[model samples]
Structure formats: structure tokens, C-alpha cells
Target: MSELARRYALALYSVCPDEQTLEQTAHVLMDDTTLWQTLCSPAIQGQEKARVLARLPVLDGHGLLLNFYRLLAEKGRMTLLPEILEAFNEEVLRQKGMARCRLSCVRAPDAAELDKLRRALCRLHHKQDVIFEIRTDPSLLGGFTLEIEGVRYDKSVRGALSGLGRQLEERRMA
Candidate 1:
């Protein structure tokens, strides 16, 4: 959640040639265990870390991204990689006119059900598309809840019970 990380990520993303290049660089950084661990691990010496980062083969031919990695090491913000990547993804989604939605339910939805929900969300949000990040929680009781573009649609059985409880409480006071 570092503002600095968001700023740096935005700066890098703006200059990124395409989403593929940006994603590839992220994959390179994340795919190398030694390089990623060394840069983010505090157990390693700063200078040694720098040397290891400098030797990352994936960084070759990616000057801007390589410099970005070096700059983070210099500023001791290597741990911000995940945050920066998240921000960059959000930016990419925004640019593509897509929204990331969270769908929570008592059980996992089937593919057909998921597609149905996706289309409804797209129509509701008026966005080009909706990407669902689905999760299941038995505690939800039944039904599902959706969070899209900061607006939440709560339709779970648990939600209805909670509303009833609150209304009863207010009525008792009245």
C-alpha cells in the first residue's frame, strides 16, 4: 500500500510498450526464485543483492524494467514488488475498460452460472467487461454477494437475516 510504489508503478506502466511486455517483465521477475528472494530478502547483503539483481538474465533487453528494479533496491523498497504489480494490473484493467469484481458465495459457481453472473455484472456496470475473482465461504449461509466497481450487491441469505435483525432491534427501541 505504499504510495511510493503506486507512483513508481504508474510511471513504469505509462512507458510500458504494451500489456504483454509489462506482464512478461513481471513474470520474469516472479519466475526467478533466487533473484526474487534475494532482492526481497533482508538476510542478504545490500551490495550482494544488487549484484544478484544485476545478473538477472531476464532483465536483459528490458532496460526500463531493469532500472526500475535497481532503483527499488537503492531505495530499499524491494518488498514493494507485489504492490507495484497489483497497481500496474489495476491500471491495465482500467485502460482496457475492464473492472475486477469479487464474487463470494457459499459454494463455487458452475461455469454456466459464472458466465450468467458475469454478463449481468457487465450490464449493470456498463463496462466493456467484468472479470470475476470468485471465492467460496460456507459462512455465507447461502446465495452470493458481489462487489463490483466499489458498489456491493448483497443478496445472500445471511444478509437478509442480518437486515431483519437490525430492523427488529430498531423497532424494539421505537
Candidate 2:
């Protein structure tokens, strides 16, 4: 995320400190393409965009968020909303003492297998909890790869084959 987005996220997260409101705001920003597009459009005047935001049901009880939308509109920074939301979510996870991991494999594991993996990852990383984002990648061939805190552990069949190929190429050159 850009520094600007992170700053905005930190400001919002600090003042609101409510996950449900932040989540609802994220949904409004992401799920409503028309609203998002209108907000981001240079053609729309700030007052018009404010009117649009004013009518949003999601912003009903969220005066701070409504003002935030106006500020973004006035500043013409609606384009930063997605990145801001991402950073905000990261802050939320940090506050909850949780870590996010990405698990890529050829197929998803069963419930028990997933639970075991979650426990193992938590113990390995010394985290209270881990939230997994699982992806099915057929090119992985068989095994899975785990990514945590920007570090990727590659145990996939495709990764092994590629490593072996590199070793063979190095021997040939030597």
C-alpha cells in the first residue's frame, strides 16, 4: 500500500476503532461499483458525490465515515480507498493478535486437515491465531505452499521440480 493510503487508514482506524463499521465501509467501497465509480470520477462534482454518499444506507450511523467520504471527495483521493481499506484490515488483524497466511495447493484440505495445519502454523509462528486464505492452484501439482508475513515456504511439487532443474543446469555449466 502507498504511504498516503496507510496514513489515511491509520487515521480512520484510530478514530473509529470499530471493525463492523470499517467492514461495512469497505463493502460499500468495494461492492458498489456504481457508487465507487461515481466517487472516483473527476466528472462528478464534490457536492454531487457528497449527495451520493449522504444517501448511502451503509453510512447511516457512521458520521465519521460520512465525513471521511467528504474529505476524500474534497481531496480527490477516492482512488486510494481500496489500499486504505487493505491497510485498515491489516491494522484490525494486528489488534486482534492474528496473522494472515496464504495457503496455495492443488486441492483444499478437509476440515480436520485444515484445523491441524492452522494449529501447526500458529505454534510455528508463535501467533495467537492465524487466518488462512486458501487458493487452489493446479500447477502446484501436489503439495502446498504457505506464505506468512511476506515469507513464502515453497513445498509444492512444481517448486521442487524447478529447483532440481536449476541444480542440474548449474552442474552442467560447471
Candidate 3:
């Protein structure tokens, strides 16, 4: 993320630290490509952009966020909304003692299995909780590979086969 985006995120987060509000705002901004583009258009005057933002349905009850959007419009930084939202979300997760991880497996786990896996990973990593982004990779054949905090744990059949192949190659060469 750009330093500019981070700074904007920090400023907003400092004033109104409500995760739900920020998440809803992010969704509203992201779901409307036209609105995002319009706000970022240099041809549009700041006053027009601010008026457009002021009339948004999602921002109706979120005065602080509405004001923040208007500020961005006035400052010609509406192009950075995505990065600001990302940084804001990261800050929220960090403050909540939670972490995000990616899990790749042959199949997606059931709720019970996912909960168990989440708890296990939390224990292993000494985190309060973990949120997983799951993906099904048929190449794995079975089992899963988990990536968290820059560390990867490969427990898949493909990984096992690759490791065995490497060992065999090394022995043959030796």
C-alpha cells in the first residue's frame, strides 16, 4: 500500500474506529465502479464530487465516513479508496488479535472441520484467532497447504511426492 493510502487510513481509523461502519463503507465504495471512477475523475470539480458523495445511500447514516469521503474528494485522493480500506481492515484485524491465512486443499472443509482447523492453527501460531481464505486445488490430490504470516505448511500429497522425489534424486546423485 502507498504511504499516502496508509496515512489516510490511519487518519480515518483514528477518528472513527468502528469496523462495521468502515467495512460497510468499503463495500459501498467497491461495489460501485462508476461512483469510484466519477469521484476520481479530475475533470469533475471537488464541489460536484462532494455533492455526489453526500447523496450516497450507504453514507446516509455514516456522517464521519461521509465527511471523510468528501475530504478525499476535495483533496483529489479518491483514487486511493481501495488501498485506504485495505489498510484500515488490516489495522482492525491487528487490533482484534486476529490474523488471516490461506488454505489450499482438494476440497473445502465443513464448518466443524474448519473450526477445528482454525483453532489448531491459532494454537500453533499463538494467535487469538485465525480467519482462513480457502481454495480447492485438485492438484493437491488430498490434504491441504496452509500459508500464514509468511510461513507455509505443506501437508498435501503433491508436496509429499515432491519431497520424496527430491530425496530419491539426491541419493541417486550421491
Candidate 4:
């Protein structure tokens, strides 16, 4: 994350004392499908962004939150708002003893499989709260990769091939 994103996230998180409420607001901002679309719409004038944001009832309850949005609009930094929200949510989850886990698989896993994977990951990290992001990539061939923070567990066929190539190169050098 950039310094700008971190600063914005910290400012937004500071406005809501309750962690859950902060998380909820972050989720709303991240999940709102139309937010970026509206901001990018050419028909919408640049100066009108602040006005449009102010009329949103969801953001009106908290003055600090409202001000943050207006500031973002005024500065033309609204495009970074989603990233700011995501970073804020990550920080909140970290404070709550949670880790975000991303899984890339050849196909979508079933509910039971997802639950099992979640349990396994919890055991691996020794943390019960794990946020899972699942993505499908047919090119993976088989197996999946689990990325937690910066560490990655590569169990995919592509990874295995790369590992084998490295091993063969080392053997040739020997």
C-alpha cells in the first residue's frame, strides 16, 4: 500500500471506535459495486463528487467518515478509496487476531471443501479468524496455492514443475 492509502485508511478507521462497525463500513465501501463506476462516469462533473457523496445516507451517520469522503473527492483521490477501505479492513482484522488468506484453484471448491480448507488454515496459522479469497484459474492444472500475508504455499502443478526444474539444474551443476 502507498503512503496515501495508509494515511487515508488510518484516518477512516480512527473515526469509528467500534472495530466491528469500522469493519462493516470498510466492507460496504469495498463491496459497493457502483461507487467506482459513478466516480469514473464522464457525465458526472468533478466538483459534483463531493455533493454526490454527501447525499449518501450510508455515509451521513458519521461526520468524520463523511468528511473523509468529501476530502477524497475534493482531492480527486476517490479512485483510491476502495484500496484504502481494503487496507483499513485488513488492519482491523489484524487487530482482531485474523489473517487474510487467498487461495487460487483450478475450480471453485465446494462448501464442505472450503470449510475444511478454512479449518486447516486456522490450524496452520494458529488463528481461528481467517478471511478466504478464492479465485479460479484453469491454468493451474491441478492443486492450489495459499497466500497468507507475503508467504505462499505453492501446491499447484506449475509450482511443482518449476521446483523440479530447479532441482535438475542444481544436480547438473553438481
What C-alpha lDDT values do all the predictions have? 0.81, 0.87, 0.88, 0.77
User: Which candidate number has the best TM-score?
Assistant: 2
In order of appearance, the predictions have TM-scores of 0.79, 0.83, 0.70, 0.69
lDDT tens per residue, model 3, 61-96: 889999998999999988888899878887787688
Instruction: Pick out the ten consecutive residues of candidate 4 with the lowest summed lDDT.
Output: 17-26
Candidate 4 structure lDDT: 0.77
Ordered from best to worst TM-score, the candidate numbers read 2, 1, 3, 4
Write one digit per residue (lDDT tens) for candidate 4, span 1-174.
677897878777676645565556545655777875675455677678778777777766767776776777677777786678677877787777888999999988899998898888778877767888999998888999989866899999988999999999999999
Arrange candidates by lDDT, highest first: which order?
3, 2, 1, 4
Worst 10 residues of 3 by lDDT: 22-31
Instruction: Please report how far candidate 2 places residue 100 from its true position, in Å.
Output: 1.8
Q: Model 1, range 11-81, lDDT digits (tens) per residue? A: 98888735576677677777778767767777776777667667877667878877777778766778888
C-alpha positional error of residue 54 in candidate 4 after TM-score superposition, expressed in Å: 3.4
Stretches of model 3 off by over 4 angstroms after superposition: 1-7, 45-47, 74-76, 110-113, 158-174
Better of 1 and 2 by TM-score: 2
Candidate 4: Cα lDDT at 155: 93
Clashes of each: 0, 0, 0, 0
For residues 66-171, what per-residue lDDT tens digits would candidate 2 score against the true structure?
Answer: 9998899878898998888888888888788788999999999899988998898889878889899999999999999999866799999999999999999999
Clashing pairs in 1: none
Candidate 4 regions exceeding 4 Å error are 1-3, 17-48, 55-58, 107-116, 167-174
User: Which candidate's lDDT is highest?
Assistant: 3
